[model samples]
Target: MKKKSVGIIAEYNPFHNGHLYQIEESVKATGAEVVIAAMSGNFVQRGVPAIADKWQRAEAAVRSGVDIVIEIPTVFACNSAHNFAEAGVEILENLGADFISFGSESGNIEELKGIARVIEENSEYIENFISKKTKDGWSYPRARRAAVESITGASAASLLDSPNNILAIEYIGKISNALPVTIMRTGPGYNEFETTEKFASATAIRSLINENEDISHFMPEEAKNIFLKSEPVDKDVYFRLICHKVLSADSTDMEKAPAGGEGLANKLKASIRMCSNLEELSESLKSKRYTRTRIDRFICQTLLGIDREKKTDNYIRVLGLSSNGREYIREVKKSETCRLPIITNINKDIKNFKGIGYGISVDILAADIYNIAAGKDLYRFSEYLRRPFCE
Candidate 1:
């Protein structure tokens, strides 16, 4: 009989104990013999550079309990939750995963699926409402809440309040071929910086690392070692890079980037002149309608040249895999349903491709800038030089 497989979509910004627990429990709950993770590359959804590079983060995940780690290209990785979830689920489905697993605050998959169903059924109405609201200076999240409330009442809209629950809905809504399995999230909340007995949110872990505090108990032994050895990318450096990129870019060009419309490009251009760092720039641009995260994402989009109109073919970029992971890859490749092109070796595989799309170019640019932020060697075409991690 063939072994069962489950897929997870995560940043693993730095793999933590909570992530390890989720992976272990996902296996237990689903009876999955293989676990595959679609992880963010150099950038994360929150519009920030990951503490460590993608390869190192993938290494940490593999060292922990994850069987396979594939790269969610930077274009989708650093965008809104909807795009992030869509890209991740598409990758897993194309990779021939039998199930898709994620962490959720409510843990009740039924309620989450219900929300997804409602939204899907009323998608046109909800989107039209949201469009009108956003045009009236309402943030997307608030507009979405109001739209949901209009159709299903406040009770259903309230479900979108939790970050994990919101993501769970997106995953459930986007998933077509794979079964959805959600593990109850424990420890601190998504943005919480507090530590628990043996678990801490990735946010807390990053904060602890920044403060040079002991995070030994927060991560698995092998993962901790990998993190300690790698240099965390400096946020300030990333901010400065964004600022530099905008100096040469005009408002018209900046408007080409994601979320850079409605005079935001001009605002960003002016803000860059006065602000010393990212926070200051975000604050200067933030208003009742525009959020700090939105501003930050726009800034990142500009730096990475993320044009919303640019069409790119999505491919599965495998970063690392354990022994079981390798066998699973071979099995999936042999299956007729697995049609997505898998790139394990960058130099060899990428060269054969006809043309790289804007989405992929953004990923390549992301790596180059990530190395700059992390103060690593800046070899030209460095993406081709680096090889995937295999254990």
Candidate 2:
């Protein structure tokens, strides 16, 4: 039998104690010798810039015990939960992982799989059910829950209440090849604002950082050091760019956006004149038909020149890898298991990776936006300028 490696799909927006715990526990639970992570780039699933750049975030994972770190496409990174989870699992599977590991409120893998089964078996009916609820002015998550409850019953549907459980369900639903292992989540839940010494949510850490409060206790020493050197993207500066994009561009041209810029694009443009900040902009544009996350993703696509029209996830980009990580990739390459080429630097390797021209093009473009947003430049933001952090 082939060696068993566990893959983790995460943002690691700032790798904290909780992330470290998940990694340690995953290794113990599955006896997987190698741990590979498919992480988001500059943008995250929430439709916001990551607290730290991809380099720092990826490096943090390496220092904390991840064997290999690969970048998920920016378009998928800044998309909806389903899109994000699908691409993440795809990349990990492509990397030849034997099993995927995740932290969830309900550590029972069977329960999450049960919900996944209900959705997969009744996909057509569930889609119709969600569509009906959406037409009636319910949010996607709300509509999805109603549909899930109909199939899985209210007891199972309640599992979707926690953020990790919802993502765990998505992972279970998306993975086609690898088995999934759920590591019990310890401490506060997702977006939990206050943190104890032993546990703090990524949301709480970012909030604390914004307040200039010390979070040394919550983050790994190495991750915190890298985080301190980098500056977080300012919402006002980027929102200024987003606001202008909404105002100057023809609403008719929004078909490239995720929701087809007709109603939602017009809503953003209509509300553009009154909004003052990113928070207000997101709030004003949110409706039953389009959500805040969808609106934020639209803005991300609009600015980065990404559209639903050309969504091709054809390559896995390496951000950072430890020594064992290098060994793992070599084995995967020799085995010829991954369908898509793995690239270290897009500018240098795009030519080598066939049929991924568009994917690389957007990957480069997104870094440019991230550089401008984070107030970094060619010194740090340029993809070709930095070497892979192989320790």
Q: Highest lDDT, which number?
A: 1
Instruction: Score each candidate by Cα lDDT.
Output: 0.87, 0.84
Flag regions of model 1 displaced more than 4 Å: none
Count of residue pairs whose backbone atoms collide, per candidate? 0, 0
Assess every candidate by TM-score: 0.97, 0.96
Tens digits of per-residue lDDT, candidate 2, 1-391, equal: 3467999999998899999999999999889989999998888887788999888898989998988998888877777778889989999999888899999999999999999888899999999998888878887889999899987788999998888999999999999899999998998888788788767999998898899889899999998888888778878888887877777787767657664554777777778889888888888877777777777777777777677877575578999999888988888988988987899766678777667777777777777777877777756658768767887
lDDT per residue, candidate 1, 1-391, as tens digits? Answer: 3468899999997899899999999999899998899999988898878888899999999988788899988888888999899989999998777899999998999989999999999999999998999999999999998888887789877889999999999999999999999999998998998888999999899889888999999999999999889877777888889878999888788897777788999888878889888888889999978888888888888898888888777788999999999998888877756666788877677776654456667887899988988888879437877777998
Q: Give lDDT: candidate 1, residue 165.
A: 94
Q: What does the lDDT read for residue 362 in candidate 1?
A: 80
**Model 1, C-alpha of 135: deviation from truth (Å):** 1.5
Q: Please tell me which predicted candidate would have the highest TM-score against the true structure.
A: 1
